[model samples]
Target chain A: MELLKQRINKDGDIKEGNIVKVDSFLNHQIDVELLNEIGKEFKSRFSLEKIDKILTIEASGIAIAVIVAQYFNVPVVFAKKTDSKNLDKDTYESKVYSYTKDKTYTIRVSKKYLNKGENILILDDFLAKGKAAEGLIDIINQSNSNLIGVGIVIEKGFQNGGKNLRDKGIKLESLAIVDSIENGKIIFR
Target chain B: MELLKQRINKDGDIKEGNIVKVDSFLNHQIDVELLNEIGKEFKSRFSLEKIDKILTIEASGIAIAVIVAQYFNVPVVFAKKTDSKNLDKDTYESKVYSYTKDKTYTIRVSKKYLNKGENILILDDFLAKGKAAEGLIDIINQSNSNLIGVGIVIEKGFQNGGKNLRDKGIKLESLAIVDSIENGKIIFR
Candidate 1:
């Protein structure tokens, strides 16, 4: 976690609208080494319980989830952001509001993937407003699966997502939580 | 790739339009153990070259690329299909025509990721018409990078994409090459 915060300080860029772009390592161009380390950390944190599968969203979250899943020794199911012709017709759908993109989109997972009473761990790169995580949780609930916990690489602590999930008694673990981003400086909690 | 062929035969569904859906293991709901085996196989096949980075497209390709990068011990960079506000303004873009979806879309890579003279190994889930692979090659060319080879998990040998790349003197390695699909039977080359 310390390594992650330090990496964020060294390589992350603070843009307008409170966006901390870690594209150099985390998202766009990935650092598989760091991801391996993060995967190990997540495994240590959540290794006690039985996790049947890891779920994440499309695009950014897919890379992180797949890497972390290696440690959990479970399959990963990524919720599709769009209704593609390739996707299954019978799916559990939920709407996610992306404050950054300023739009709400439907996220779906095939009914075949999630089974009743199966434990699912949700992982992602960033948690800003927790909208994406909430959407994944909604889909998991619809499948009658047991919500294990949520693992995040970087959480925007200034946002209420972490707080809301904690208030709901959800076991949430974020490697690096950014408490504030002021004048291009990222302060971690 | 015998394991892959067996898995495909067992789980892969053949649709109406000659579409071999391996989403059960290769994409969508991904099997991490199978993906690890795939990463090892890809490393064994492409181990002779010095691969600096692994590149792929977004969504489906990201999971495969990241897992494959673990064996190579290099970073993975996926081309973004959509221009998001989060993406860098300066990007190397190429248009890819998706015959399956019946649409053409632009894929972009941040200029900072792909350096000149770097040896990049392009990895992807499928190669039907090879439009996606061609677009990735175009981006690599624009960046002045050396494409070591294109490694495909499944190549439709009946399609011209594999021939086109081979004709261009590119080292294209496909794990499983499907020659034909007749009445739900997949004939491998």
Candidate 2:
């Protein structure tokens, strides 16, 4: 976590509307080395839980979840944002509102992927409003699978997403939590 | 490669319109172990080339590229399909026509990631019409980067994608090239 926080402070770009762009290393262009460390840290944090599979949302979370899954030795199932013809007809669906894009989109996973009573760990790159996390959780619940915990690379502490998940008694582990971004300076919690 | 072929023969769903769905292990629900093998095979195939970075398109390609990057010990940079505000203003863009989506979309990579003269290896999950690969190649050219080769997990050999890339003198390494799907039977070349 210290390494991730340091990397964020060094490379993360702060923009208007509290957007912390770690595109240089985290999301857009990825650092596999850093992701491997993140994987190790998450494994250590959730070592006690029984994680059958890792679930995430598409576009960005796929990289983080796939890399982190290496340590857990588990398969990863990503919820697709679009209704592609390739996707299965029977799926567990949830609606997510993206403040960045200013639209609500449906995220779905094939019903064949998530089975009942399977232990699942949800992972993602950023946790801001918790809409994406909530959507993934909804899909997990619908599948009748057990939600082990949520692992996030970066969390906006000023936002309510992290707090909301914690309130639901979800074991949320955020590697780096930015308490605030003031005048281009990122304050970590 | 044998393992991948066996996986496809066993779990790949042959749907109408010549669609071979490997969502059971490749894209939607990912088998990290199989992906690791894929990484090793790619590394072995492109072992002689000096790969500075792994470039791929977003969504499914991210998982394969990241896992493959482990073997190469390099970073992975994915092109964004949508024009998100999070992406940089200055980008290397190219248009790709998706037959499945029945539309042409622009894929963008930031100017910072793909440096001029850097060696890049493009990796992806599927290579059908080669439009996606062509788009990525165009971005690489715009950035003045060197494209060492393109690695595909499954190449529809019956399609023109593989032939087109090879015709241009590009090193194309497809793990399993499916010659044709004959009455739900996948014949690999």
Candidate 3:
């Protein structure tokens, strides 16, 4: 976590409205070496949990989840943002509000992928408002699966998403927590 | 390669219109162990080449590309499917037509991640008509990056994408080539 924080400070760009851009290593352009370390961290934290599947949203979260799945020795199921021709007609769908995009989009996972009574570990790159995480949790609940825990690379501590999930008694572990961004500087908790 | 072909035959679904769905392993639900094998295979095939970076598209390709990047010890830059608020304005964009979706959409990659003269290896989950690969290649060319080769997990040999890229003198390696699917039987080349 210290390493992630250090890399974030060195490479991450702090934009207006407390936005942290970690494209250099975390999001846009991925650092596989760092991700493997993050995966090891996640594995160490939740290795005891009965995690049957690792779930994440498409685009960004897929990379982290796939790498982390290797540590957990589990299969990763990513929620598709759009209903593709190949996606199953019968899907567990939920709406995720993206503050950055200023809109809500439907996230879906096929019913065939999530079975009843399965233990799921949700992972993502960043947890801002927790809308995306909640949407993934919603899909899991709809499928009658158990939410083992949520693993995040970076959590915006100022945001309500992380707190809300913790308040609900859902097990949550964030590698790095950004408490606030003040005067174009990132403050870690 | 035989392992991949066997997994596909066991779990892959052959739907109407010659679609071979291997979402269980390649996409949707990703098997990291299998992906590790894939990554090693890709490394062995292109190990001699100087691949500076691994490039892929969002959603499906991100998982494979990230896992594959570990083998090349290179970073991965996935092309964003949409213009997000976080994505840089100055981007190398290209239009990709999805035969399955029956629509064309623009894919964008931040100019900062891809550098001129950098050798790039394009990785993808499936290569059908090769529209997606072509779109990625266009983005690479726009950024002045040299494409070392293309590594495809499954290439629809019946389709023209592989042929087209080969005709263009591009180095291409496909783990499994599906020649045809007849009466729910997948024929591999």
Best model per DockQ? 3
DockQ of 3: 0.89
Superposed model 3: Cα runs more than 4 Å off: none
Q: What is the lDDT of residue B80 in candidate 2?
A: 95
The TM-scores of all predictions, comma-separated, are 0.98, 0.99, 0.98
Per-residue C-alpha lDDT of model 2 across residues A8-88, encoded as one tens digit per residue: 888988888878899998888999999999999999999999999999999899999999999999999999998887988
Residue B59's lDDT in candidate 1: 87
- Candidate 3 structure quality by residue, lDDT tens digits, B1-189: 999999999999999888999887778888899999999999999979999999999889999999989988999999988778887888999999998778899999999999999999999989999999999999999999999999999999999999999999999999999999987899999
lDDT of 3 by residue, A135-178 (tens): 99999999999999999999999989899999999999999999
Interface RMSD of each: 1.1, 0.8, 0.8
After superposition, the stretches of candidate 1 with alpha carbons farther than 4 Å from their true spots are none
DockQ of 1: 0.79
lDDT of each: 0.93, 0.94, 0.93
Which parts of model 2 have CA positions greater than 4 angstroms off? Answer: none
Instruction: Give the CA lDDT, 0 to 100, for residue B16 in model 1.
Output: 71
lDDT of 1 by residue, B1-189 (tens): 999999999999898778888877877899988888989999999889999999999889999999999999999999998778899999999999887567889999999999999999999999988999999999999999999999999999999999999999999999999999987799999
Candidate 2 vs 3: which has more lDDT: 2
Give the TM-score ranking, best first.
2, 3, 1
**Global CA lDDT computed for model 2:** 0.94
